[model samples]
Target: MSKVALVTGVGRRIGIAAAIAERLGNDGWDIAFNYWQPYDERMPWGRDAESRAELVRRLDRAGVRSLAVEADLEDAGAAEAIFERVGAELGAVGALVLSHAESVDSGLLDTTVESFDRHFAVNTRASWLLIREFGRRFTGEHGSGRVIALTSDHTVGNLPYGASKGALDRITLAAAHELAQLGITANVINPGPVDTGWMGPELIDTMVGLTPLGRLGTPADVANLAGFLCSPEGGWINGQLLYSNGGAK
Candidate 1:
């Protein structure tokens, strides 16, 4: 089997995608990541070019082949193009990890149609297309294939991101059964409230108080679970939505 993993939304080293990529690379998997610079530039935290470059360097030092592809997942063709490029560069992918999201906070009445459509286009639609392409071209050994999607349950103030993630959960969970003949294990993970440079001090404090752990989740915490799910032992945990939050209610 080709021990290649395609992780999406790896625009910054601090992000969960980058952590997952590093963990998988350390586990002897070749890494192929997708990122969109425009998305990072628009976000409140902005882009981290140096951190991204450092991540590549770290992967190189770990002795695993790594390919970084700049792609806008909002484009319908991006999914197929990504797969084609990764296949050409790093052989067939054995695992697909979706960590990308279109997150813009807006309320129920305030969310724009453009924002809603864009969210679904990138989060929901792009994920479906990527999974479709993965299923079509998967040549890994039976039971070695994996699909993992990072999702969220927070939908109060964040309408589009949360709603699209709901749709993503269903799409990803379906693959466990739908792609069972191919021996793929599909699962969704909700890594609740990882700061990753998005939260202010006040919000961070509030989130910490809400959790029993009394600390904000870190990217490494999510990466640990992601790494496990892509491992051979994780093949039994399929078609489930796992909450890795530290008892946050």
Candidate 2:
């Protein structure tokens, strides 16, 4: 099997996507990551230009090849472009980790049409397109292809983001069967309440109190599971939504 992986939404060093990329690189997989700075800049936790560069340096120091592609997943053509660039730069991707999202806190009564459409375009449509490209271009050995997506179930105040992620879950799980001929295992992971610089002090305390582990989930926690799922040992765990949420109720 080719030891190449494509990880999306790696725009921040503290983000889950960056952690997953680093973990896979440490596991000896050549890493190709996609990021959009504009998304981070607009978010409450602004962008860190140096962090992106530092992540690439870290991957390079791991003795594995690393490529960073700046992509706006909202563009319909970005999926194919990412695959083409990664294939030419590294090799055919054997594992795909989708950690990107278009999240904005808007309730059902307040969510606008534009916001809803953008959420689906990035979270749902882009995922489908990327997976489709992966299935079409995959040349890995039988039972070598892997697909994993990060998901959420928090929908009370975050309507569009949560709803689109639900669609993403279905689209990803379907690949486990639809792409079975290509020997791919697909699954969704709901890594609940990972702070990743988004939660405040009070929210952190509340989350810790709620979790059975007495602490909020970290990016590394999710990364560990993702790395395992991409390994050969994870081939049997397919078409399921596994929660790595520190037993948060």
Candidate 3:
């Protein structure tokens, strides 16, 4: 049977999220993608409609239906809008991947309440709100759907972004427990210093040297794992925080 999957914060990047979306699409999963507008200071993997449209085209070529929605997921209503779009365009969501988020690079002393609010809005509130809406609507009987959130290696770090991810990590676990009653498995994927656009080449090289894999993670690397987690083959897995880092601290 075909399924529907929602991937947020996807436009351009190394390839992890995109790879994940394509993988799901290839596996007969319809896709709903989200992209936040890019700032003028940077252009990540050509962060534009063209890039996403191309991805949608590719998914279509692969024989899967797809739709791209522009949304400010930080807003409380953003998740609802996305679901509504999917309901109208696709069908029930078989998987929800909360992959759209970022950091402002604020430190402990520099961290302000406003900044905290901003980060939590995108990284936390958005995910919870999506879960609230999706969880309430998605019935597990349709082959057990998945909730896979993108997290960071912050559970072991004290960075602001790390703290934000840690909060997401906790939330995923909690959701896993609560959503289990509905037969949905909630989990978080914490990728370490991936070579994605977020971490530049210099840092990636350093991390590669430090890691057991001896190679920086590509978007496909993370996406591959995401595919597995969303598969019925992974039904035995739930409420776990898995790392894709190559054994680096």
Candidate 4:
């Protein structure tokens, strides 16, 4: 049986999640990806069902089995539902890519408790639950399992989003220390300010100027790092925040 990889937040064809899924498929891994349609519809950069279907079709053409699961990570039962679907449709998951995040922008002054909770539920809580389930179901008889989460280190205007990702970072590192005996490796990636239709013209120009590489980061840039981290050579790299940004400090 082909190894299975589960990637979350693949609601659009041009996003980072789609890139990661496609890269993994090309690498000979069956894919099980999760998306929240309603959430995507409400985002500033809305997504349609056809774009998602097109992504799945493209992955299918890569000659790997693919399963697209609609799940709301904010729901308490969402993690189990995702794993159950993957286990039934594909085989045991050998790798997990957590690219889904709540990107609601609220500065420290305007951030509300409800927004904070909601952000934590999706960004931090859901990731921990999924990791717990993945670790629970992984059988160490094979080589090893991989867990990679995408995060941001921003501090202002993204209070809830940034803080929640910080929580996810801690959870990932703890899993790395505790789950190593079971042949599991955990790491986080910070892909810094990729324009996935969320930024306006002014913001885009500002970000481009700030980037030392003289160009905005692309989904493919992040996907390349994700592919490498899940590969056999990446087994030795764990518990570290791998920055794929082009020297954007």
C-alpha TM-scores of all predictions: 0.98, 0.99, 0.91, 0.97
Error of 1 at 229 (Å): 0.9
Q: Residue 142 of candidate 2: its Cα lDDT?
A: 90
Write one digit per residue (lDDT tens) for candidate 4, span 1-249.
578999999988888999999999999889999999888888877766686678778888999889989899999899998898899888888899999998888998999999999999999999999999999999744447999999999769989999999999999989898888778899999999897877889988888888898888999999999999889988889999988888876
Ranking by TM-score: 2, 1, 4, 3
Instruction: TM-score winner between 3 and 4, please give it.
Output: 4
Candidate 3 structure quality by residue, lDDT tens digits, 65-84: 99988888768899898999
Better of 1 and 3 by TM-score: 1
The candidate, 1 or 4, that scores higher on TM-score is 1
lDDT score, residue 58, model 2?
92
- Clash number by candidate, in order: 0, 0, 2, 0
RMSD after CA superposition, every candidate = 0.8, 0.8, 2.2, 1.2
Clashing pairs in 1: none
Pick the winner on TM-score between candidates 2 and 4. Answer: 2
Give the poorly placed runs of model 4, Cα more than 4 Å off: 140-143
Cα deviation at 231, candidate 1, in Å, is 0.8
Model 3 spans with C-alpha error above 4 angstroms: 39-46, 140-143, 155-158
Evaluate residue 159 in candidate 3 and report its C-alpha lDDT on the 0 to 100 scale.
57
Estimate, for each residue in 2-111, the C-alpha lDDT of model 1 and write its tens digit. 59999999988888999999999999999999999999899889988786688789999889999999999999999999999999999999999999999999989999
Query: Where does candidate 2 stray beyond 4 Å?
Result: none
